[model samples]
Target: MAKHARPGRIDPTWPDLPDGEHPVSELAAATQGSLSPFGDVEFPLDDVPYVHPVTEINR
Candidate 1:
């Protein structure tokens, strides 16, 4: 099975989608800008550069 489920349909809210390419910044926004995978807190996108790759890479 695919480790990460690709969105069946791109979300319009994500202007970064549909084009089928996402930059590092756009990927973070798609996750609602979660800083940590721990689920306790979220960091603002502007405040945080990008969600750490290890956390999202396998998601």
Candidate 2:
């Protein structure tokens, strides 16, 4: 279900970085002091119901 870019077109999902800016270097700088894991680390999942993909598809 993900949107893909055409053969010669840039993906809109990606950030439009300035010239000479490397993606790896930009990522490193963005998470420079991050010590926590990704996602909803602070959210409580005990009350959330797990829905199977097949079940969701049939809904």
Candidate 3:
């Protein structure tokens, strides 16, 4: 069994995901500045930064 973080709280210093979970930030970074195909039109995909809730509240 793996340990899970408590609800409504996340550690920005060590953000760990449960099994089979992938970070959205990783996906965003991987496709950063790429184009998304959208039915005869392509849209630019911008890299959106992910800010933790704690950090956001502190700001």
Question: Model 3, 1-59: lDDT tens per residue?
Answer: 98886866865666588987775544644455544444334335465456666644554
lDDT of each: 0.56, 0.60, 0.56
- lDDT of candidate 1? 0.56
Per TM-score, what order, best first? Answer: 2, 3, 1
The digit string of per-residue lDDT tens for model 2 on 1-59 reads 98885866866677777997765543555355544554435456556667666644564
Better model by TM-score: candidate 2 vs candidate 3? 2
Cα lDDT, model 3, residue 11: 55
Candidate 1 lDDT at 44 equals: 54
Model 3 TM-score on a 0 to 1 scale: 0.21
The candidate that wins on lDDT is: 2
Q: Which ten residues in a row have the lowest lDDT in candidate 3?
A: 34-43
- Give a tens-digit lDDT track for model 1, residues 1-59: 65675677666575554576775554656456435655645445347555565644664
RMSD of each: 18.0, 12.5, 16.2
TM-score of each: 0.16, 0.24, 0.21
Highest-scoring model, TM-score = 2
